[model samples]
Target: MPDRPATASLDNPRYYLQNFRSVLRWVAGHHADLLTPQEAVRLAQFEALPEGSQALLVRMVMRKGDQFRASKLSYTEIGPTTVALQPLVSQGWVDPQPTLSLAQLFALLTRAELVRSLQAPLAQAGLKRNATKQAMLQSLAEASPQPAPLAHWCPGIADTVVALRSGPLFQRLQLMFFGNLHQDWSEFVLAELGHQRYEKLSLLPQSRAFQHRSEVDSYLQMQACRDRLDAGEAPAAVWPDISRSQAPSPWLESRRARLLFSLGRMAERAGDSTLARQAYRLSTHREARLRRLRLEEQQGEAEQVFCLVSDALKAPANAAEQLGLVRIRQRLGRRLGKTLERLPRPAAIPEIELVLPRQDSVEMAVVAHLSRADAPVRYVENRLLNGLFALLCWPALYAPLPGAFFHPFHAAPADLDRDDFIARRQTLFDDCLATLGRDDYRECIYQRWEQKQGIACPFIHWPTLTRELLDLALGCIPAQDLQACFERLLADLRAHRSGLPDLIQFWPASSRYRLVEVKGPGDRLQDHQRRWLEFCLSRGIDVALCHVRWQASPTAECET
Candidate 1:
């Protein structure tokens, strides 16, 4: 017989082949539904292995289940048909499952193999609790009718058997184990397994079922109170009264405090000072114990409560309350300021100009129409013109821009003296207005402003030949262009600087950067403008867009 081939040795080939066949049979019988067609082929290949290797294959598959259960995978639904078979390859006990994607199977299999090895050390190190051990064994037995031979070698096997004999730990272990196993099986398995276990356990007649009716009612009431408060209603008023006929319990007192706080705020809104004070005082007294408890237990809530008390005291009619409120407010403000100071300051504004086209002709017409009815059109013009001038005079009103002259433009005069200067300024303003009205000019200005300066002009209004002209002229523009224009205007003023004292220093060397963009409500930046804004951002420029509503009201005194 050729001395019996070396490949067929009993210790190797025959042993491995027999084990492999057994594993194949076990898998087909227990997990046939879980295996894909491709996986089924791979499983068959393992079945063809020598008996010695077959035992290793069975161990590998079993390890995969143990690993899945260990990692809390049992919490998720796992179908029997989709059982991953790659754990065997990871153990070096079997060749890689050839019919399945190697990468997909490697992770799961590797985890299982590693966990199996770790389990021995973990148990020996006393990391595996007796209850955990029992739960694991019970899950194993339930999963497979006959435990694999490898189970005998597990370090905690004896301890697990002892635990299964009795006690609360045993029951808990059984619940956790089966809970996880059912999760591995299917979604319906959890409910089914739970029901079966309940019936079996119920036979003991000593097991107590949990009741949640009172707990659920408490939660519902709390939620309803929160909902009422969120909707800006007084929760105490909206919630059913539970305090009048009965002495207040801790719960009722807490509810009362919350209600009182809500009522205080409502009273304050309604301008009922006496009622508001009464409500706030009631809340403070009712929550006194809660305040003390919070001080001892919750630092955050204690501080908040202190703040609320202080605020109430500050406005309190009595001297004692006022003093207390003042001190508390000051302390809180100091702490808040200290914390705020630790935060980083905003970035400095970069030198840039945002330009938008002038569109004030129609607006100017409306102003002119409204002013035309008035005896003095010049007064209306002067009011509008002065408003623009006042804005330029205050550089701080518009930020990020270093000065008001950040945009290259000149303001219309409060009053023009020389016909020559007036004509020149009027012409310049008209040219800008006319150009802004044209689509091409408007689009170009819009794109240029957005890209270079990051601004967009949506619509135009005209105040007059003067006010509208000044507004358009003073609006956003490229910084370099603004500088050039300022220089030219200054030169022009110096040459004709004699007659119009009002136009003195048209280009103030003290000029600071100021940029502002106005849009109607709901208006947003245009696409090209948005792109330009990105460009300005990349270059680090300061810009702001504001929605402005223009209204005529009694004018205030001028700053200068």
Candidate 2:
């Protein structure tokens, strides 16, 4: 027998087949203990097949559907289609005769093919030859015909359809390989074709995503629940599948928390406050407790709200949650007629009022108006801080810790946004951030900027991160201030990653900078943006809120 190809190359005619085999080998090697008896037997059976048969099976599996017409099964490298398929049929991997519903038949057959096959039915229904495929399907749907073999549906239509019986097995193997269903066979092809490049990490045998078989099962179950919720199923209907007991894994627990939070939001939208409260109470997601407090306050449960808010304020998850808890407590205090200690109000954001000629983008107008010879204003928004953090912390972010780097094609860690993301790599991140205290931090940033340029990162926008901007940022923004901003980002990556000021004005000569948030006519600061502005102001950062008004056009003025 030929040795399995060491690498997948697009130049090979059977690159997809090679990729599929690689996945099987990878899963068998890494997840052998997790495989069930049936899966083990199936894997052995698949290996026992001839090369052509294996290639044929893989080709069918990679395609969208399980069923395919023999005429469509034309791969030159796999030799004769029937010759390749015979072994698959003998091994029970492909069903030569399988039942398919009318819907399935409709999907398989073209409109013209349908008319030719179902001529009698169409004629009986008095439908025109020019009738749409949809019309024909709708007309036939009323008859409720039983599912039957393709031959029965389209008798002697010069075609044979075969169904691959092991799509679910392939799916399970893929989940084991990729650690998620969102990525599929294309990742291998993309990597081979040089469309995307990933960091090379030294993976140990124990570094696989799933330690126990139950994690795989739980992931699939959670995925199904999410799918049902997305398909417009009621929260109450999907609630039973959400396991009340927590999983031992932090990543799995995070998935459950996020799903519960989603279900709670859905319930709240549907006006099921009780169900929403139940979901929120059970969820360990950062926003869940705050949402629950808001709901309770709405339902006239002020005392309960106060108790929960007080407990939460003692050890709030992050700044956003802490800020929310304080507001809830203040409202409850007002209602309960009790004086409470208040958090010192953040200094008001300095405002700049601009009345300018109407422009398409208010931000650009502000940028044009604020630009000067020595002091240049650019629309940096959230990019500058995010890019710098990503560059400085590349090592920490891409650390090949177990359960983080499952595959070779990952753009970012699987748990980058998870609650324990920072906790897992605290030491590495601390080492990376410690540079901010020293002078070599600028060189470290520049080195990463050059070496890892254009590499896929969650935070870095390579297209917009120019050398001039980098120089300006390094010179103007103090290391202490960058450290503070980065610390806040690490504190709550998901919540604090966005809502930065729209623009930054830099005085490179003086090594000074000011971050500006722009608001157009009738626009107000969003809660998240306000939170960010408050954070900046509290840290003694130079930031301002700019409100712009559009001057009336000549035609508008004449009409008035």
Candidate 3:
């Protein structure tokens, strides 16, 4: 709860121990109500232990597995491993005589150690000392040994295997602190090494991810099922656990929707349409409704799909979904012999044909062919526009609203992808966008670009969006155009973030520019690219699709 102690400094060899202590304190302070009685007791016990014992235990918890060879568990800061492990052994936090299967035992010991330890078994099975680890294990397969203490397996070996009993408890605390299992202690190392730096945010008590213990348990449950699913388990096999793990929190509900959507897709791939439909119906994921409608349509249920699409059209989830729903509705209307109003056709995106000498990439070749002294072409792709938007709207994006950010390490808001993300900070975003009307907008963008350089952001790409590119864009592109593009981005951050034109040609002298989407000889426009191009066309922005053909060279006659 207080500032980190001097012992926690990065220069200290025991920094990891300090990090573990910080996490324990943070979890206890913010999530006190959510902690179980047993967890609270364990935390108190862990704190009461000798510092060396605590460090050793933290080291094992941070390691790859629960089991460790006593010989392998040496640390300079913790002094002698034996002395540090004594408190752990006394407190029953570690099992000195851990039961390990043959596989686990083989993983912990070297081949030479295996040969020396099982000499009698090897001799009985006609295996020599030169035998491989697998061969030695298989030779004793018929006389299958039950899992027992390391002593039972290798009594002659002086080393002991210590299994940390509190690994799972420590893991729960970690999950509560980070809000997910994917991010681990390595984040601290990254920050300390300056490979990654985060915005320092003032975290309030309620800024935490989970409001109740049930949400934490639900997240853990969903994560376990997700792990099982990722491990190639069938959807049907893991469905029951996921089904029972639903949470009322919107964030957890979003996770549930994603998991269910994945399960639905897996079920569909497995030829279980019934299960797939059920999963889709249960999910709140945006694509789930569209997928369900398409599946129903395939089954000759046009009327049902028609009704759903018509209702969905009244209040579409986002632009992408709205586009899909319109198409579905139009198709169903025609099939049902009902007349429906049609939307106006989008203006055609102008196309250009170029035959250029091959280069590293199609985009590079196109840039080479199109670029001139006065008009310079840069492969901005999605980076330039997204980067500019990120720079201008950095304040709104990183606003310390409740539940938006809980920790200092966040690259962006936690609710960036949430539905109400824009509405919650509409005024702030409007103010940011309002600057575009004045000359100060350029300075504002440049200031943030310089200030927040290399800080992790969802949209800003520091490596590619250089100052020259920013200056060229600001000089050439009109203020209203930037505002339009930024507004479209805010419309559906998830959908409109990508699929931008690959190259931008700047005519700085005349204050003009053109966006080009490059395509190779056989390539065609994709849906998202077309969507972006169409959006540009509707906004009166100059955009062109360039089709590149490789220029042929004359071959030498019959040298062979």
Candidate 4:
């Protein structure tokens, strides 16, 4: 590691401010060309904000919390007044009074450590955790008004509660970091499970959500118990009873199977063979069955284990499970057929590049060599980001194009599917194209980007980019290609923006580009990567998946 500068210290508040400056300089130095006139103005105004506001801005940019309490902002370095944000407020850069409710707070707390620390009952005969949480919060609220301090449970509870009640979330993240708060359907849906748990109802048409908050609480408690059992820490006196619980849908069943699998692992780690097998036998999850098979093999209970694995094979199997099944079959010496031909290679095939684990460095090296050779060939990884940049600007050019809704920083619609998106693409593309055709579209893009004019927006990762690269993306890349990629990305923004190749080889003179996804040895295509590859193939996008093999001495591991 490099030596730290003598002047740098976490104790100094100014160090944070200096970090803010460093971040701003990086953004300015990289995306300056992509910035529209209005964006430049907005960014300049942000830089000139009061020192405290600047500090607060950096705080929001760096953390997961959306809203912040005025009290939390009442520090010396950051101005005491949330009202200092009036400039930002007027420009829609900040929502000073975002709405939040008690129900929301309870939902958030159920998953939080405070509830876990309370040693709260999961299945209290007829009661749910939601009821318990609300009752507790009600007590706190009642206590709050009596001029007595409420029992503060955690370090950040007061700040969190205050934020939930009336704090502001810096909603206009695209202006600051070119993205919005974390907004993915999976995350939102999973978090929302707490709400369904509170309501004690199943979100079956929904997934991840459960009928009881106790369901989650019990899972959490069991996980804790498992960890404690493994680490030799003391556990709570009581535990949640899974059998006495209400009838479970498949999702809950799968979740419980996972928990049982975890318990089996903990028991195995603790050297409790009987307890481990009991947990394993109780679980429907395939991995648990595999472990049971192993244990039964060790105990010379071959018949019991074989019957168990054979029954387990009835359930749906993913790639990993299938591999496990194959391994178990091999262990039994029954795989004397074509199944052996389909097995994954145990080592790298010596036919590719010279990277061992990952090709990130090799890809960069290859691209760097081409760049140095000056063959008009440059590596552009974010050839896709340009498409995102264009999509983000659409709402500005076509006011009705859903700028009131969609933006780059924001995730695309959760309910929206690929077919629906493609069906509506014509009208959207027309409006965006119309917007881009005008000489003033530049101003529109800038204003929208500056003011954060949409609910759904694009997010840019600023660190791995440069101004020259962005310029090349916008100028040298073909507009048609950008449009094609943008349409594909919109088909399912959650799924499609990923899986792009590690590097792109671009010919500036011919405006031609080829994608190269470098793989080292045992690397295989992930689901998302496969999705991207399929899209590229269908669209005639020249893409190659290159596998690399590493040559190393037998003592390489010892050397390391």
RMSD (Å) per prediction: 30.4, 3.5, 4.0, 18.5
Candidate 3, residues 429-490, lDDT tens digits: the string is 99999999998899999899889989988797788988888889989999999999999998
Q: All models: lDDT?
A: 0.33, 0.88, 0.86, 0.48
Tell me the deviation in Å of residue 15 in model 4. Answer: 24
Pairs clashing within candidate 2 = none
Can you write out model 1's per-residue Cα lDDT over 508-540, one digit (the tens) per residue?
232322222333334554433333233334444
For each candidate in turn, the TM-score is: 0.16, 0.90, 0.89, 0.36
Ranking by TM-score: 2, 3, 4, 1
Per-residue alpha-carbon lDDT of model 4 for 67-171, expressed as tens digits?
555555555665655555555556555565554443334444544553553333333323345555656555445433222111234334444322321122222
Question: Which ten-residue region of model 3 has the weakest summed lDDT?
Answer: 551-560
Clashing pairs in 3: none
How many angstroms is residue 366 displaced in model 4 relative to the true structure, after the best TM-score fit? Answer: 3.7
The candidate with the higher TM-score, 1 or 2, is 2
lDDT of 2 by residue, 75-194 (tens): 999999999999999889999988989988999989999999999999988899999999999999899999999999999599988999999889888887777889888888877767
So what's the TM-score on candidate 1?
0.16
